[model samples]
Target: MFVRIVKLSFDPTKIDNFLSNFENQKNSIRNFKGCRLLELYRDKANTNVFFTYSYWDSEQDLENYRNSDLFKGIWANTKIYFNDKPLAWSVDKVVSLL
Candidate 1:
C-alpha cells in the first residue's frame, strides 16, 4: 500500500472556509478509485494546521487521482486558504505492529 500524508497550514481566519471545502469534497476523494482509506487530522497546538492521511493501492493510483478534475477543483479551492506551501509525503510501510 502507498501512504500519503499532506500537511497544510491555513490562514487562521479562513479555517472555516477550508473546513467547508473539505466537507464538500472529502467523500468524493475517499470514494476515488484505488483509494483505500482517508482521514483528516488537526494539530492540537494550532487549529489552523491540518493533515490529511490516505492510503492508496499504488503510486500510479495516487498519481491518477492527482491528475483528475476532482483534485484540481479541490486543490484550487483549498490552496486559496493556505498560509504556507503544503508539504506532502508518499511512503510505504516498513513495519506494522498489528
Candidate 2:
C-alpha cells in the first residue's frame, strides 16, 4: 500500500471552513478508486494545523485521483485558505506495531 500524508496549516479564521470542506468530501475521497483508507488528524496544541492520512493501492492510484477533475475542483477551492504552502509525503510502511 502507498501511504499519503498531507499536513496543512490554515489561516486561523479559515480553519473551520477548511475542516467543514474536508468533512463534506471525506466519503467521496475515500470511495475514489484504489483508495484503501482515509483519516483526518488535528493538532491539539495548534488547532489550525491538521493532517490528512490516506492509504492507496499504489502511487498510480494516487496520481490518478490527483489528475482527476474532482481533485482540481477541491484543491482549487482549498488552496485559497492556506496560511502557508502545505506539506505532503508519499511513503511505504517499514514497520507498524498495530
Q: Once superposed on the true structure, which residue ranges of model 2 sit more than 4 Å away at CA?
A: none
What is the C-alpha lDDT profile of model 2 across 6-89, one tens digit per residue?
Answer: 999899999888888888888989999999999999999998888999999999999999999988888987999999899999
For each of the candidates, the C-alpha root-mean-square deviation to the true structure, in angstroms, is: 1.0, 0.9
List the global CA lDDT of all models: 0.95, 0.92
Q: Residue 93 in candidate 2 has what lDDT?
A: 75
**Candidate number of the best lDDT:** 1
Estimated TM-score for each candidate: 0.95, 0.95
